[model samples]
Target: MRYAGIAWTDAGYRVEVLDGAGRRVVEPSSWGAAQVSELIAWLVELAQEHPLAAVLDSTNGLLDGPMTAAGLAVCRADPWLLPPRPRFGSVPAHRLAEQALRTPGELARVTAEGGTLTGRAEEYFEGVRRSEPIQAALTAAGRCFEHGRRDTPQVALTFDDGPDPVYTRRILETLDRYGVRATFFCVGHHVAALPDEVRRIVAAGHEVGNHSWSHPFLPDLTPDQLREQIDRTGEAVARVTGEAPTWFRPPYGALTPEVLATLEGHPTTMTMWDVDSRDWSRPGPERIAATVLESAGPGSVVLLHEGAGDRGQTVRALPTIIEGLLERGLEPVTVGELSAAPSDRTESSRQPAPAERP
Candidate 1:
């Protein structure tokens, strides 16, 4: 009696059977559809003989619909266990080397020993793992709700790189007039420079998130630098607001393998905006407001910048954007509240239809 597993790899499917001693009893590979079918049929027969539990990897299981439908049980291993592929086109070797620096134990050992993998590859591995837990949790939570989840249209307004004394105050006033709340991704240096503004953001009940200390591209920095960027920023936010930030938005939506590793187990949700308002470019207020209104939908994280440059247009655009959302029957909410909001299926005192994902 033992356990058996099937894993899909770049090379094809691999089947491994383990005996009571946790030793491999059988190993086989199937390269073609017919071979895969025969191998799976063989595995089922072997399972009956040994009364073994089948633990096929989920990613591999999905590849063979017949195997899954045949009642084979599945477990998931890190999807990254396979060889890496370029997200789009080929990436530079040095960059890949940097990304690889984040994997632990056996994987790291193999990557280091292979000498073919780069530091970037290690970093990439680490970053993917860092955000995996949060994504898994959210997805699981979403699966729990079954009814009352109306897929209603909704939108969220988010401002980043901010807590500016002049512009933020004006933005807050507009939001207050509309009785709306927005999320602000505050840079650490900005928080330090504008403690009063940061405190006002909290006092006004807006959500605050870390946007890194000085908005550096995370992957370019070493592990120590990456840690310092996040740690110092969080500390600065705490010093000003009396509470550590629990949300993080990487600078310019950029994440590197090392950056992801450095963020592991941190009590922050990495946030990315769905819409860009071009406020930082000093676009006309009307143009900025129109862009937000046009692009926003339910579950949209509309991005605006409160600092980083003159934001007079952004200040001017706030009221119009708020008004437009209200007219379209949307409520502007902070990212935290949005995450905690009841799913479309649940009926609650504050329950509303699920907003569309931007």
Candidate 2:
């Protein structure tokens, strides 16, 4: 039997294979994200040559679906459990392979299960209900507003769809470097999956908002479903962060008449954005930085993302965005802080959520 470890890299992944005797079976090779299919094909061929099992760091959860779907016996090893190598920053692919070969029980087998985001959310809620008290539905929902006061010199950098094991920490480091406090509107299951990351966000003085339970289109959900989505997410976040999120941003800035009516009394502030980085679109770093820099001004809420996919470009562009905002004399603050300014500010400069999509 052979063990193969795949470590995530900005380029894609680095693969290392080891034989039963702890000798290198194959020289480490790197694969770009675009070449995942080829990587899988190579792994399949390797498996055909000898019985093989693949190990990936838990942060590389995104690769689990594809690798498992291709019939690779994939397993996840927690990076936190790896013994520290003082000078070496991150766990290397070779170390992961060595660990798998030495202690196979430490790895969790990855299977073709938990098919959809919605399914994962339901599963998470079931576990929570069994162990934790369900939180009450929010008592009142504030009017949804995009930007804060134009007269205030504060702007907000808000991330959506996160608690990602990797990118969220990277983004946090960038925010820390600049002493900036931002808001993270997290997906429910993501929060449940990585509560420690969510706690870290709060510990670092960043605000957290509810993005949704499953990131579904609110307009399509019945009133009960919508409430469950919001409530479940609220409970999941509160379970870890110690407080229910005080703000909610509908997935995709999607708010229709029925959705709004249903949320009328739900306590979370419906926060939207004025300047959109569109980082979720995976635009190049320059484009992302330019979009935020060119449009953001006083009281603008800039939309960015830390999770839901490869957010490398967003992470790369963040420093430039922070410096650019500082140069413009705008203070990057939490949404709660930014929104608390002058409620009388007009909406002329704010970007309204688009009309419900057909």
Candidate 3:
């Protein structure tokens, strides 16, 4: 059987084509996606000359389309290319440190060496390091597409600063009644305070995102600190819900270039709202609903808050907001579903959810 491997590097992608005996048929070097596709096609033709089963590294999901199009059976490489297992358990923060400590071992070496960890050790260690969780979340997010599903216009409803023991339940109940799904951007402290609420949010078929560990302005922190904020929050959420958050929203609509760079390879998508209801300021349900309706459009991500103080306006606005979107020919979806693509619209018109009512 022949195998092909593709790796993205600082210079570009390195494509390798191997023959039946695992001998190199093509040398590896920087190649663009289109060139890589051409190379793969050539390799497949060569493989056909030998009539052998072909294996290809598809960790990035890049070859999914082309491989399937070419009638090639593509299997994802194990997190680190180790033997198959039932599941790769969570990688603890300390384990990541331990792996780093190894410095020269296979586990530590892969990450330190800087390439896509495509082997078994890489996947296992990544899970242990909480790397896989965040990456998985981000992968789920990037899969969001607009015209891929159907032509019917769909909208997503998202609420930040939530999982509040008091208000989140009410919001969930409303969502349940309407058979709608929304995304909740949760604070680490809040999730820690109300673990049950966090679980309930997940169980109710809703999506959750990281608002931050303490809701700090991302731009205010150093790159390392910003990562810490996101990591800590992801760890907390994963601890309670068995899943890491895949979406992130900077507090106060603040994000810096450093913050973006810090998040580059972490796997969570940066989510911003499109339709702002201004419900955080006690804008009244009528005004909140009206604002959302006025701004609603195809692929809109509406921002609402279930917790963060005096969310009564948002709570009251829910049915009207959903109804209004429906009235305007929009289908409310989760932020995961909304921000899946560049063309996807998100509603960010709302004020910050009120922390306290004056």
Clash counts per candidate, in order, are: 29, 5, 29
lDDT tens string, model 2, 1-358? 7988887543356889999988999899987644656788999999999989988753343455556667888876654557642221125789888989888976777655431122234434444354221111221223565777797888999998887778899999999999999999997757766789999998998889998765654554567767777888899887897788878887765555566667766877677788988776555999999999999998899999887566789999999999998998999988876766353233423745222110
User: Model 1, 32-81: lDDT tens per residue?
Assistant: 32244466677678766776544432122122223443444323223344
Ranking by lDDT: 2, 1, 3
Scored against the true structure, residue 6 in model 1 reaches a CA lDDT of 51
lDDT (0 to 1) per candidate? 0.59, 0.73, 0.57
Candidate with top lDDT is: 2
Pitting candidate 1 against candidate 3, the one with the higher TM-score is 1
**Which 10 consecutive residues of model 2 have the lowest summed lDDT?**
132-141
- Where is the poorest 10-residue window by lDDT in model 3? 84-93
Clashes of 2: 5
| Candidate with more favorable, higher lDDT: 1 or 3 | 1
